[model samples]
Target: MTNKHSETSFFITAEEAADQLGVSRATLYAYVSRGLLRAHPTDSDSRRNCYARDDVVDLAGKRRRGRKPVDIAKSTLDWGMPVLESAITLIRDGQLYYRTNNAVALSERASLEDVACLLWDLPQADELEITPSVLPDGWHLLKAHYAKVPIIEALLPLFAIASEDGQTGIWQCDEARLASGAATLLGALFACITGCCPDRHPLHVQLATAWGQGPVGADLVRQALVLCADHELNASSFTARCVASTEASLRMAIIGGLAALSGGRHGGMTERIETAWQAIDPDNMTAHIRRQLAAGVEFPGFGHPLYPQGDARAKALLGSILPDFRFADEIVETMRALTGKAPSIDFALVAMRRYLGLPEGAAFCVFALGRSVGWIAHALEQRRQGQLIRPRAVYVGPDPGSSA
Candidate 1:
């Protein structure tokens, strides 16, 4: 064990800290800005800084852990056992929090625009007003390319155009520009999805009008949008962060999110559940489910690992509908009996879309739209961190000298 003198000698001067870490003064300052280091001001000269011994040792240990192959290569992409830190969102116990507010509770009062501004730390505005004049001119091409494709698929080309919109040199771009760009991208995508309404209303209003629903329908749209706005470090949000770590444009980063959301086990799970629900004969729900099970088919929307009791988003959304819709009530009852689990967000979205008379595949469209706000929020945050997210992999292929 070390003596008391050695224990008190742990704190070091700025030059000593720099030499010990083997990093330049500028890099050291950058670390401080990134919240990776803490510096204390000296009594005689405030300009001269002293770093805590434990903090420096922790940073050094993190650097070593990052370099070690076994630490990097332990795959936990499904539930992310490897904790990737972000200030964007947090899930505590069973509730989800976005920064300082409870997400499910926030959805009870806030609009999707309010949630977006809150997540981006913009000025407190009740709504995000995006003007139509900033709309990209490539809608003609987008219409041609995605004429026969699902609206979710069209997001790829739509974002590609938005990414090249006069925003140059990403590293120097400011927060206002990023936020405005996100608003425009969201507004334009909504226009494309809903068959191009000319009214420049708020996002929920535009969607409500496009689907020909009045106040009741608009309320559902708002609730779903708020609930789906963000989930902490989910697959798509992580993809957005990864792209932004490379200093990619916000649009490109959101496009990365869209690509990940299209995967079968992520957003595509909603599509599968929608298909299953459509096939159900509500009058004879039990017989229908039994037939499906006898045929070795498993229903997709009944359970979520994160919400064992039930998804709060699903409960809030489904609660609003089950009281009114007879068929939806039957579907829920049958699913619960078969699996002993409650419906998830995917199930709620599909049921809500059907209740509103939206066309098939509209559930995925809503999910993608609502989640785009989260993607942009994450991208902006990742940009501020200024760190590349390249996790290393352990090599297990043939040796360098071995022949194929």
Candidate 2:
């Protein structure tokens, strides 16, 4: 196609456009064939083509789904468009922030309750206290029923009980009441997991006491809870928000979040890393790492797509624990030298739990406990917006009349 261009307009040659998209010229031509791009004939020669620099730059951010070019209408779902707007959290520059505050920095000193208030935008000056209470009667039978099951597995029955008992009314509360209820829910979950009554102490101290640790463990638990509090539109958070959008109770919404978090890809990520760490002999760290590398097996905790340089959360948590623990330092240093990649938050959590001699699924439990706060905050936010989060689907199914 012949097109007129102004002298001030920006344009790039075919080679430059291909380089910009990180694709071969043949692939660029295929894009042209698919009408995703148009080649403009220059005044000097029709054979020489020029493309709009703006168009090339825009297309650079797009990726072909699977082995095929995505359908034009559906392509926007792949990071091309904003599905929803939220004022809660942001993931920018490979760092996480809650509202306007830096989450990592806050994790150093803020309790999980403080972070929850920040997330919910509750008045900072108000008394933010969650009174711990004894479980209701016959709860022991309920606890006994799930005692032999995994901690996360037991969460489902408790969720049902809370919903049935109308405890899910927290979502329908005012901002202040909602914050208080959130704290109570978090404390209750912890109590159920450890079989200890919720203490009036700060969440970290309570967790440390329940886990049979001292001051150092309390500090680490605090940091872990703060770090794990919230991430923008993550799988579980999205699930929570979606349920809330349906006018479900806060407990139901959090239950949805917990269901999603239990998947192997989410909080269960730590379990995989812990299993791998358990298999390796730390005495022969180098040899074991090399063998795993040679076998073409990927170490779970070392790499993360969101943080190409490294996960700041991992860096902070590892730095905090490594000085006090020797094996953790060795595992971290060896993994870094071997993979040239830093440990992810998953890896750091498993390392901390192992070093502290916590239970088998402690890492996952810690994550779920902390993330419940975020889920509550998100559900409350979604409730205020009063909008359903339904997205349209493009069907590629066969026609019903097609008998051939």
RMSD of each: 8.8, 9.6
Off by over 4 Å in 1: 1-68, 123-127, 136-138, 162-164, 168-172, 197-200, 399-404
For candidate 2, the lDDT comes to 0.77
Instruction: Evaluate all candidate structures by whole-model CA lDDT and list the values in order.
Output: 0.75, 0.77
Q: Alpha carbon lDDT of residue 128, candidate 2?
A: 64
| Residue 397 error, candidate 1, Å | 3.6
Residues 250-294 of candidate 2: C-alpha lDDT, one tens digit per residue: 878878998998887788888788778888887797788789898
Worst 10 residues of 1 by lDDT: 75-84
Question: Residue 249 CA error for candidate 1 (Å)?
Answer: 0.5
Q: Residue 385 error for model 2, in Å? A: 1.7
Per-residue error (Å), model 2, residue 88: 1.3
Off by over 4 Å in 2: 1-82, 123-125, 162-164, 170-176
